[model samples]
Target: MPPARSDDDTDGTRAALGTAPIEPPVAAWPAVGTPADGLTEETGQAKKPRTAAFGFIFVTVALDMLSVGVFVPVLPRLVAEFMGGDAVASAAMYGLFGTAFALMQFFFSPLQGALSDRFGRRPVILVSNVGVGLDYVLMALAPNLWWLFVGRVISGVASATAATAFAYIADVTEPDQRAARFGMLGAGFGIGFVLGPALGGIAGGIDPRLPFWIAAGLSLLNALYGYFVLPESLSREKRAPFSLKRANPLGALVLLRSQPQLMSFAVVQFLSQLAHLVLPTVGVLYLTFRYGWDTTTIGFTMAAFGCAAVIVQGGLIGPGVKKFGERAAVLGGFACGIVGLSMQAAAFQGWMFWLAIPATSLWGFANAANNSLMSRRLGPSEQGRLQGANACLQGIAGLIGPLLFSQVYALALAAPGTFPGPGAPFLVAASLLVAALVLSVRATRRPG
Candidate 1:
């Protein structure tokens, strides 16, 4: 016979689960153990662990930025090389590249996020990384603009890795520790942003395609690393039922309406992305036209911005969230965005351009904090859905921001002798950020 239970033991078991014996909850991603199967209690075989899985996700993101930056320095020059130094055609082609990437991301991010939820995060990540590597190889091989568009489409699919990565982090981490992990990813982004462009600048000195080759190599390395080491975070039992319609970005809109807090985050996302909208496209062109910066100079200036951002978001931002609270961090980030844009508009000399460096760094710090706080508001069950929604909001902002900024950039270029030089669009970006600051301040009053 089985051992007899004492009366007290029976009562304790009853109390634990209303008349059933209860098992202790398992700790997730502990320092020593492999994650067990979704429905099984047994722990899996031990494997070598590296936090670089998280860093790999960020590297993918940073390389995407690098690919953009690499092309950026040589874009005008490359068009010239091919089209007999046609400044207008170069500008148009450059803008088209930006438009293609943003447009494809807008359409694909939610789809990838949903697919990861239904299938598993690891597979999605592997596929996306491979896509990005291929995108770079294509860019390197492309003889003309049409191939560049193909490369953008391929890269955009992989760019969704970032959203899936955040979902993967959510899957593995405890609620309290998530903000710090998210900050680590942000920091990785900052590091990549710093290194990729600097490398691109160096490659640009040799050949425009060199940066693409380097990005491809880095991406290939990431894909190989993930295949061997990165474990699946999403469990088969916990995954939501997959639907093609859910994969459609329109589902994110429905999610926005269902969750009030998510709606608020969507607003914050739109504002933050809008603030960044000017930087990648118009910002680079503005600096180049206004200061007569060469590719290396522009690359270094961008790298400085990335370096400062990495420091603040990686080190300071996480602690700020824990100390002052997410609301404060969000408000602070918006405020910094306003300051950064204003400084960019007001700066005259080439060196004065550095003023926007700290401004953008502060922006990065604050935005990181805000994203962490937003992620905290959702339950584990909804992590991928919520992150996918967030990405959709960012995608919308990216799509619209470029269109708006490109128009302003064209206007400034058209009438350079008149208007406020190239600084007019930046001033507009500042004004928009100021409005966003007020909105973020108002959001702090809601319940966490």
Candidate 2:
């Protein structure tokens, strides 16, 4: 070939590398300063296209809540069926269920989030929905207590749609608007609680397993809707290649190291979820053990909590944001949580318990405001990253809260009754909220 010309040699080299024109690596897409990198989303200036994706995510997640909440009423009862009717054992089972879910999330949420960053949000979402649906079916058919454990384990791994959903919003939003979008998801959480539990309670009366079947069906339906309708939000150019460390929950620690503001917000997020973890797992156990209430009475009490959350998230959140600004709303919300915690801890009678309703309403409000604040702080590119980290933090709380509450409950039973009451956790959780309030005030303070 006559000592191949320089042009010919260059062409051969380029061909071997499969870049005849020297195309840039896909890493360049989300690289700092790239338009598609999600930086603009942090600005809270997402265009119409991003808004549409946000709406899609909201719908799918709402469906997830519908299934999960519907099953809550029956979870303990079903466990009792296997424990030879020992309530304590059943309660332990419930705590174990939460432990399984939270522990898995501790590892999985970040992985899913990072993967969505690379593979695009659509597939991860679709897979999660399917996994959630399957989880419901498994629980419904569980032949023994172990099966229930298996179902929870599987579901926990699969129910990570929230991570992908958050990423989708990030892909389309600006940093400033992230909080508002996240608040909308919180609304979905509230709505799911309102409808899911009420319906689950009713269905559970007929057959303890009925709610699980219904939830499974809904998850499958959600999967179908998602596969057909959810568009790809993270484009090929914007994804990061998957890394073990980045995909793990520890990624939050790694990513937050460089961003102190984000780290502070993440701490607040963890504490908030920690407070919640005490309630859902231990609250009902307290009512039943202390007051000897049945499913119907328990359902009514929880309904009160759920209804308040619904109204706060779905109805009042927008106005609150408009009136108070995100920071003020957050502070006010936390203040409400403090009040509610006090009410629940002080409740020695049913009427006093009712007072806790308004307090939880405040908790809902504060959570919404915090979410909105965090959203605003992120650039679009960082949305999935932060949300994933947030999920992991919640998972961490989930893991810690149940074990702590269960241990406390056990200790109270064991000692000459020293752990105060089921309300003790609420007291601790409340104090934590007060600390959170102080932190929020400091974080949002304007720099001189």
Candidate 3:
């Protein structure tokens, strides 16, 4: 871990990490610089989407996350029910489900991004929507825990299209506008946050499977909407041949190595992604065990968190970035995460937890800022690949995060009293963010 850099660059090598002004990558990949090397996929390409069409990407990611959010509060409970309400067994099984899901995403993410690069983003996105919709159907109908587990695997494969969606954003946006646009895209996640959990909690209260049905309808309907509204973001000439070498999980990591500057960012991002998984994997369970909250309470609390995210990402991100710059924003986000998660970890009363939501909500500014910065360093032809590489990191985090946090939580529960309590998972997450904060400082430092 030499501070992430291509220090060999003349002067611009220092630009990407500097605070005053950031320059483009001096050594952007030239091997695929032009669209010349491979046979392009035969899929018919539509023209680049209109500016208004940008809304489609936002909506697409929203619907995708919304479907995910709908089950967050209840999925663990459903597993618990199948296990005779044994919390420990359910936690272990849920971690396995998460790990299995991440395995699929790890394998498929680069493929999804590469496929979008070849065939175009529109079809790749639409197909993912359909796949997700159908997977929800499977989950809704699952008679047993393993059946639901299988559904999660499918969802991971489908959800890997998030890389493509980000690629779509890169395609349509200017370099300067990317950070703001990325923030707007995060607002989509916020929308899901606000609605999905609340809806799932209410619906899940009636029947744990009900939220999946609702999620299925939403995904299908979104697919239909996209079929009519979403056009291709990548033009035919801009398309690259589908390279299996860059499409698999291992190959995707090679893509990260291919760019020396991205290594540090990718590493920091992996830690951030690992920290993020705690909420989904153990947040609900932690709430249930620690605070005695029911399904509805968990959902509403999540909704509140979502609302804060919307305000920060949707409303404040652009102005914040403009005033503070991406590096500053990134630093601020990590600081917020450390404080917020620590606050959540220390909160003994349920009401104190509410104050932590906004701080954590603001943590997304770091991701949006980091993405904008990374996307600027690559060419259009490689945006998908870069995001694929990043998603591969996320897949790895997804693989590790769930098991680590869930097991920590379960172990804490088994403890007699004092150390590693129910708050243990957040404390661990906060620690990961602290590591990220340090790594990011090194990554963002100007080259010597």
Among these predictions, the greatest lDDT belongs to: 3
For residues 1-448, what per-residue lDDT tens digits would candidate 1 score against the true structure? Answer: 9988787775564455332211112321222221321122254443322476666666666666565565655655655666667788877876676777777777777777788878888898888888888778987888976776677677776767677888887766644345566777777776766776567667889988787888888888889988987878866766777777777789856766665655666677777778687887686788887889887787678768777877887788766655555566666777777887877877888877796778667776556655665665554545677678778887888878877888987887788677566777777787777776776665545334
Residue 436, candidate 1: C-alpha displacement in angstroms: 2.5
- Cα lDDT, all candidates: 0.69, 0.71, 0.80
Which residue ranges in model 1 land beyond 4 Å of their true spot?
Answer: 1-50, 74-87, 143-145, 288-297, 348-353, 406-422, 446-448
TM-score of each: 0.79, 0.80, 0.82
Compose the digit string of candidate 3's lDDT tens values, residues 40-71: 23532222336556777787788767776777
Residue 273 of model 3, lDDT score: 87
- Pitting candidate 2 against candidate 3, the one with the higher lDDT is 3
Q: Give residue 308's lDDT in candidate 2 (0 to 100).
A: 77
Q: Give the count of colliding residue pairs in each prediction.
A: 0, 27, 0
Ranking of all candidate structures by their TM-score, best first: 3, 2, 1
Q: What is the C-alpha RMSD of each candidate to the true structure, in Å?
A: 9.3, 13.5, 7.3
lDDT per residue for candidate 2 within 109-164, as digits (tens), equals 78788778778788888888888888888888999999988998888788777877
Which candidate do you rate higher for TM-score, 1 or 3?
Answer: 3
lDDT, candidate 3, equals: 0.80
